[model samples]
Target: MTASTANAQRFREFKMPDVGEGLTEAEILKWYVKPGDTVTDGQVVCEVETAKAAVELPIPYDGVVHELNFGEGVTVDVGTVIISVDTDPGAGPAAAPAAQQAPQQAAAAETEDAEPQGRQAVLVGYGAAPSSTKRRARKPQAAVPAQPEPASAALQAELNGRAAPAPAAAPAVTPAAPAAAPVAPVANGTGAGSAGRPLAKPPVRKLARDLGIDLAAIAPTGPDGIITREDVHAAAAPAAAPSPAVPAEATGPVSAPAAAPEPGLVDVAARERRVPVKGVRKATAQAMVHSAFTAPHVTEFITVDVTRTMKLVQELKQDPDMAGLRVNPLLLVAKAFLVAIKRHPEVNASWDEARQEIVYKDYVNLGIAAATPRGLIVPNIKDAGVKTLPRLAAELGELVATAREGKTSPAAMSGGTVTITNVGVFGVDTGTPILNPGESAILAFGAVKLQPWVHKGKVKARQVTTLALSFDHRLIDGELGSKLLADIAAVLERPKRLITWG
Candidate 1:
């Protein structure tokens, strides 16, 4: 069963790994290397987008990349071999195709029969997870020829009993067995049609709907004949070709159908752009849905005059202690929030639904909502209760910069007990921000605008802003929620409370 017998001497396979947090799969966002490219051990071969974040994957061993198993934009399973590297490139030319595949098959078989091994070699900062990445279960069923299927299709194959590898799909095939002749399987024999209902998961099905591509027409590269996002995209490319093909519509910008437009009908599909939901955006959507439904949320809004807080921000900017630091109203706002949390520590807690009890936390990992190119992510400033003003400002700057560049680690985004979302950055009045899952409260800081205010019993123009606090009603009631919001407003109104209340 050892691979060193023949082709194994030259070729070594690298499989996709669970990045962290029990992520089962990742999409091959981009490939940094190609076939015959020389690579060193620990060289980053490609970037992958998992449900949590975008992670760059490095090859665990040194070699020349013999082949790339999947194309870009394909979602691959955790244990699928992504790239095959020829470890002994110095030995002139490698073996034939059949010779190369034999050792790969043998090594794959060996892996299935092998015992649990050491921690998978992924990038640092991810915790060690239970690695049960065996592909043995699908050997008898899927038997794919090194093609990686979408993770969703793999899940369907696992739960819905084993399905046969579907026949190569026609670019214009439909589910009802229409007059369209099945085209030969394109690329990797993944899109061939079978004599049965086209097998595509709900999301892929929706993607087909959005693109106006028929599932039966796609060449499914997924295991057990599951159609994937790549297949849908592939089918769309040809459907837009100038050749006379029929029975399929398209919503993509490249779409050009054979038929003429109606006299007065607007082609809405032509103007629409459908981005498939996956990765960070997909994870964020699911988290928001879970939080919105599971947590009893109550949002309270307050308008506060923060003329003094704004003045203190300028004073702190010139102070020698605050020199070389990001001195802004947000720094004081965050500091005031921490001070308020210190006064009303109960706000920094969560509802343990399983235990039916309130869990009070002594330390606060404050979450800051950041919008990145990938999606909305809340990477937190850990242990903000203890960091000084300068230290807090430094960490906040690092966190924001990292998130904007899409380099924030998964560990940095977790373990938050409270959150602050500065909506004012977008120049809005205020908004009812949703609570981050598992966190009890979220404070929305609005834009500081100059408005007429009754100060010292007389109406005058003052720097005023609105604050909205959203809390878990199960733990923080109306009174506690009001007090927390009021305390934050009070500290902002009187900048000296940072010393007295803090």
Candidate 2:
């Protein structure tokens, strides 16, 4: 209505971006900025879990946060505005639009008659719809007044009143002065006596519901008394225990494991769970299936004595050149694979189905398959072929750390030329690893075991392991694949060849 209001600040909406592999949607795992926080360009505003990885999204502009469009754990579609930022905070509030003014007036009227529901009011266009369940009656002494309390005091009163049970000797306060006087709710339900809502992300709340665990029963372990996923899982563990044995007549023999029930006969309330395939696990599954079916895989295995490689790993740990770096047999194996690629560059090629040609890579973007909590992700060391051994080790260490922390960026996992999966960590003998999509080869390193071997015509115990290399038949022939794998095996067998061949 006034000039000051006419020149009010305009809000800008920031949409969620596709963080990896053209992902369509991502769940908001955590929000860093609240409604009133100031944010700068490139400042990370929130962490989102996509189908590929957990990515931290950086705001592209400087502004004051106006409102969040979605709550934590809600999966927001790509290109949907997730947050609104006031670009010109110095400007005064804009006059409400004609359509919004009527709604705002109606909301205010509704608020006047509404009782304190012991939960924060949900912002429009965010969070789950309010439940239809009726609120329990308030205590006779805890009546709310017609007037609303100030925002800050109301928030504090709600927090303190709901945090724990009130003492029996506490004095009753009139509802009109609720803010200055803390009024406790009547104990009836699991969440009764709490004026504030339980602090939990959407996923944790969903987990609690799925496990039929009461959030109020579990003590909070997160910051500011928020319940975490671990806390909910801890509470569910005891309840998840199996029920009394089913009668033999109802099932089958008790000694033998019960047969899987017929499709429609399965119990709906069975103890077993069926977790949905989504996020990283879903993407990984699709990729593996495509790679397995599309590519004509040719796998070759070789048993090699890696005693020298094991000794070199120990020696490098003590070496000043490799001090403070990750020195492991995997490092040497990766280096050996790189050297072998140089010797047989044809193996470092990708088959371009669209162009119907072999694309040979001059430099290697060495990929290491990391098994993370999310799923199996292959993040590569960029320009690994050119990096010195120490630099390579450092990059490997950083890559593994980032992957483990679920912070591996989309860029880090892209453009991989070849991959090495260390299945040996799980004590696997060897595996025919499928090629990473677009790459020609993936090498599987098996566990090293002491086996009897002929040394200069005498039987002796030696550290031996098996290596399996799977490559694209279209781009890499049997001869080229064998030569490349043999070279890698030879380098590991001697360990000194890394210095000579490298």
Candidate achieving the largest TM-score: 1
Q: 178-260, model 1: which lDDT tens digit per residue?
A: 23321222112333222234555544665688779877555577753557777787778744544332222221123444697
Candidate 1 lDDT score at position 383:
91
Which candidate leads in lDDT?
2
Per-residue accuracy of model 2 over 1-502 as CA lDDT, tens digit each: 6643543435667899988877798989899999999999899999998887899999987888887867787677798888877777776766542322433442343334345432232223333224335654554355544332344233333334432222234455656533433222322222222343555655567678867887766556664355778888777774554434544433334576678888878576666776767678888899999999999999999999999899989988999988899899999999999999988887878888898888888889999999998889999999899899999999999999999999999889899999999999999999989988989999999999999998779999999999999999999889999999999999999988988998
Estimate the Cα RMSD of every predicted model relative to the unseen true structure. Answer: 12.8, 13.3
lDDT scores in order: 0.76, 0.77
> Candidate 2 — which pairs collide?
143-175
Error of 2 at 34 (Å): 2.4
